[model samples]
Target: MTETLADFRRRVADFLAHHGCPAGAAPSRSRRPADHVAAARVHQRALADAGLAGITWPVEVGGLGLGPEYRQAFAEESAGFETFSAVFTIGLGMCGPVLLALGTADQRSRYLPPLLRADEVWCQLFSEPGAGSDLAGLTTTAVPDDDGGWRIRGQKVWTTYAHHSDRALLLARTDPGKAKHRGITMFVLDMTAPGVTVRPLRQATGDAEFNEVFLDDVRVGPDDVVGAVDEGWRAATLMLMNERVALADNPIGSPVTLDAVVALANRTGRTTDPVVRKAVADAYVAQQQAELFARRIAGEVRVGRDPGALASIGKLAAGRLATQVSALALEVAGPDAVAWDPADPDGGLWAYGELYAPSLSIAGGTEQIQRTVLGERVLGLPREPQADRDVPFRELRRG
Candidate 1:
């Protein structure tokens, strides 16, 4: 007795309309992060009440025990509206998946229900000052305590929404004597723990969408450990793969950016400029290509295909296309693109996109890393030589 896709879509649409979810325009001022979280909690509560929030999750954890196609349909239809549920992206995207894949039965029972209902928020605590791309080379340490728990001490940077997170899925070295990747363990750390501190990092766009977190002797019980000790790297890889796939599928674009750029070109009397027209056309083409690739990747995931290197392809294309589209938006806007004053209200959208373009190549995964992954894992290229691959983490050179 499963609901048909069309029926589920109609139910979602009707529920959204009844709740006054924004349909066309960008989310209103009430849709700020804090507000968005609150709204998402409300919406998720309704969704759970209607048995729709975790469409692809198991029924034991309050899901419908449905397939990925149902989740894909939900995402597609949800993208057509301006919903506040995006505030839970990190929770639903990275943390939830990691928990589902690696969490023990007790851990899953304790965490998944609230997560599916958006009652709690989660963030990833993985990247460190020396670790990002070479994540296995992280220096964070977790020592076992007499109380049958662990004391964690470390820093994680580029943590999205750590400032608002209720919990973090953290990675730390449990055995420095083991090889770099073999010594690590993943734990669920309470963000409200006494020594947990968060500082929002302001980006060029003037938004503190990311944060830096410092953990000082934060104690976590044995029950918090996810997967096997020293097996965090595998869990992390799975999460990163999911992250690449989800980021590639992010529906951040609007017809507005292109429309605004076109209007600006016509207003500046540059619509006839051959170079400008070509840039616009090329940008459109790139967007179409990226979208098609993303759609294909989404289809693979819907049918339960492990995307593997295909996710890298989508991520790489997304990064390149973002840069190209943003550059074209700036070109179309001409002189007006120099400043990112949203108050200007006319051409500010183009300027904002241009200003934010550089981040696309770095966020989720760097373009270089994406290409390396694609080449090695996808194309069966020779593996990169690593001096530290078999070295003990404690004996490795710090610099």
Candidate 2:
């Protein structure tokens, strides 16, 4: 029997009320990464037990095998409450989707169940020292071993939560003799393997939410390869598309809302200023616009349609909106935002949001990258001329 949307919404709301963290219950940004991960695992296990997690995944992998609309409904219902989803965002939203789309049957069966229940965590190993914006130009190398496996050696920077991840979807150059993009391969890397090192990178927000990873001849079995060898670009493209959508639909990390910003304005007596009022109004409208666009993109995915460039649009809007809302909150916070009393622990929320705002634009995909995708992919514009597009990666100049 198919459950109606209203019934699903009620079920989600009831579950969240019992198990969800109330909005503003804690300063999420101030929480340690390990603390967040621990709480999220607990929350996810409970949600999975109640058939709320993996709302759109297949039944064979312990999901309810529901439609995408159910997932969308859950997102809408759970938006106001902190579901502790940040820790598993890369696993569930990005890696899980990629595995589902291109993974072998064995890979899907082995990984998806644990991921849905938050029994494991995942991260992405795509951004390298040389491949932040130009991911295809990465220098990471995976050499074939005598055991029919591979040994990876490279560095990946800005890896979110690598310190705690159980696995990661890694991209490396398997055939540098081919063109940069054509030579790449994706693998499911075991984070606990030998020669793998994770070093946390403390951001300006005083949070170690990102990390830089080093792989010193880390061994990966043939079973760990995702998609076909030397053809990972297709799988990578799918993941990136899903990443933009996920970043849009799910505010994975600690996100500040307009309501909180407005309340700060009211408390600080800034609401009376004409300029402040106008900025608040503008922020509200922008929030609505971004939300509506996200919903539209979700609808397309619900029907099994690829969002493609539309995901980029939502991502761009979300990135801009994060900065706009957080900046407004900081402005309203005035002196307290800069230096709050030590006794008042929550007083620095606005400051944290302000510092975290810049990363929102930079993460997932940059504003400039998103715009380039939109212009070239959506508007049917001419492709950017890369002088090294057809050149072999081994022969390319290094920084």
Candidate 3:
């Protein structure tokens, strides 16, 4: 007999309790980056062992092969518990889906199982110094080697969790003779390769969660290519759309809750302040709107409907809400948001949230890019004028 949703929820709840944390418990935010990675792997392994991970993916790729309703049920049941799956966000959210959609059968058989179990962490290596917003203009080059493989030489910046990742999904120019977006190819790169270097970029939060990766004559077998050569733009676009959808939940796991901020306002004696009260109310409403928008998109996708560019709407809304909520938290905390006692980890969390808030608007495509996508694709607006739209990558002038 098929299991009911209530039974599935109870099973998940029992697993979560036995695994590490119980429901309504907060995630440990003060752990070091490496510690977080270790905990994520352990928790993800437990979920995989319990058959709770990859709820909607194919069973052939180490998933449960269940419908999207099961996935949604799992999300609802696990809402309050701390799963520590954020470390695997890029792998499961973006890379794994792209591989399933455009990868070879062998590639899926080799990569997806370890990914589902967190046996190997993955990151995205698409952004470069010159191509943050204009990803298609990336100058990274991957040339065919004499050994029927490829040699990649380029740099990627703003790579999340790269230092802890075992693999990465890379985009590089395979044919500079073609137009900027035409000659690209996607590859699965081993992060521990001989010519790969990862340097962490310290954020204002005093953490090195992001990195700059340098590749020099990195060798990749022909089988590592994700999709057709000189046609990576299509694969990249799909990955990006998936990324925006993933960002709707704020996968970084630091959600700014209204209750927590309200408690802060009461503690700081700002509850009576009209200005602060109004701002808090506005932030709360925005948060609810963002959540509803995300749920709407998720509902459409769950039923096998294509949200298309509508995915960008949720991402844009959530990013802005993050910034607004964090700023309001700062107002509520007053001076405490800027300077907190070093011994108290919880005291510094809101401060950290404020610092991390700006990145939400920047990552997974910038706010401006999201607007442009919505404008052109969803609103049927005219395309932005680009003089070099048809120019070959090599012919375009570089700064």
lDDT of 1 by residue, 50-95 (tens): 7677777788888888878787777777765655534666787778
lDDT of 2 at 328: 84
The all-Cα superposition gives candidate 2 an RMSD in Å to the true structure of: 2.1
Using all chains and alpha carbons, the TM-scores for the candidates as numbered come to: 0.92, 0.93, 0.93
Clashes of each: 0, 0, 0
Q: Clash pairs of candidate 3? A: none
Task: Provide the overall lDDT of each model, using Cα atoms, as 2-decimal numbers.
Answer: 0.78, 0.84, 0.83
Per residue, candidate 2 scores C-alpha lDDT tens digits across 1-399 of 877899989998999888888766633535756776777788889999988878788889888788877877887788768765567668998899999989999999999999998889999999998898888988889999998899999999999889888999999999999988899899999999999999999899888978999999999998989999999888899888777666656644335789888877877778789989999989999999988887787777767677888788877787788889888877788778789888896777888878888886788778898889899989989998878878888899877
* Model 2 bad stretches (over 4 Å): 1-10, 26-29, 252-254
List candidate 1 stretches off by more than 4 Å: 23-31, 83-86, 248-256, 266-269, 340-343
Ranking by lDDT: 2, 3, 1
Candidate 1, residue 72: lDDT: 79
* Candidate 3's TM-score: 0.93
